[model samples]
Target: MTLILFTQIFVGLALVFTVAAFGWRLRLFNALARPVDRSTPKGNPRLGILYAFTLGMAPWAKESTRRHGIAYLRGVAFHLGIFLVLGILILSPWLYLLPVTWRTLLALGAALGALLGLAGFIARFAEHNLKALSTPDDYTAVLVVSLFQASAGLWLVYAPALPLFYIVSAIMLVYAPFSKIRHCIYYAYSRLFFGKFVGSRAVLPHSQQGAR
Candidate 1:
């Protein structure tokens, strides 16, 4: 088989394993005994869950995000780029059919995401408090993900560079379940639980339909 074919197979298998690993994790999480709140809820748990998935991501939604709005936005950009990369990978077969201007715009967006991710990686070392709080896994995860974005951006610009993108993507995907990247999967669940508890307890204001 050709190198491109080999890498495609490698990445395809890696993607499968990554999905399986994440699915297993979700299964385990679901199997865990859920803590029952015996207290009568003062507010709506459903409303809280809705807020958690929506307004809770707003800069003014959480204290930390509010305080570090720019950082939060950078993270948002990086993750958005990741989502774009996933879309590109999935639609790669028809990439050639896309208009040149559209492809260039998408490539630029991915490149910006890669830059933001790289900036975050640098901040982990440059910021004293952040550096102190970071572990090896944190650094490794950020670097690999930044590289993954970079590879994706390059592949978007030059289709001949696809093998590199696939290989890097394979590595990132395989390591995701074993590293801090797994937090991506857990983030939603944590937000959901937090919103439910806080809203039910009337601890945090829920972003109800009329309010949001």
Candidate 2:
């Protein structure tokens, strides 16, 4: 009975997120804000490449953190941890607990990645709430996601009543579409859009574009 209910919940959330993401991609609810990529890089080609890479990270790394002192660490941890955790979670045999020699390494990598992500989130929350740079929506989104992640971690630790953890995860999945957390998907496209848009406008110097 519990397993059936949990399976239903998972299927339901998957359907909703998939449909909502498709809707978002269709520009159903997204406001058509014009491109805001006016900050042009200087003549240094290496600097321009660096700028492009950093712009890719800017979506997750809140702009507000720059006013505070945590922009570097927050940006680094958030991006690198996201990369590591996402990669290992998808590719590692640990996903199925399959017998493999690399399971320990993958487990450690995932743990460290999650920890790094938590640190980044903590830094963002401190800068936002404690420093007064956060909007109400910002605070709410961060609080919700932080709680969701912490709950997931706890569930993994206790291994108790998988249904309860599934409930929490389901809530996270539903909330993510409506919250700033959707930026996880939105950011990648935004980066490519920015790059192509800039290139079309002849904003990037030729030497930088030719760098292969």
TM-score of each candidate structure, all chains considered together: 0.93, 0.57
Cα error of candidate 1 at position 41, Å: 1.7
Candidate 1's residue-wise lDDT over 18-121, tens digit each? 99999999999999998788997777777777777887778898798888889999999999988888787777767879898998888898889889999999
**Count of backbone collisions within predicted model 1:** 0
Clashing pairs in 2: none
Ten-residue region with minimum lDDT total, candidate 1? 203-212
Report the C-alpha lDDT of model 2 over 65-135, residue by residue, as the tens digit. Answer: 55554546654554554455335323322343544445445445444545655665566566546547655
lDDT over C-alpha atoms for residue 107 of model 1: 89
RMSD of 1: 2.7
Q: Give the distance in Å from residue 127's predicted Cα in candidate 2 to where it truly belongs.
A: 3.5
Candidate 1 CA-lDDT value: 0.87
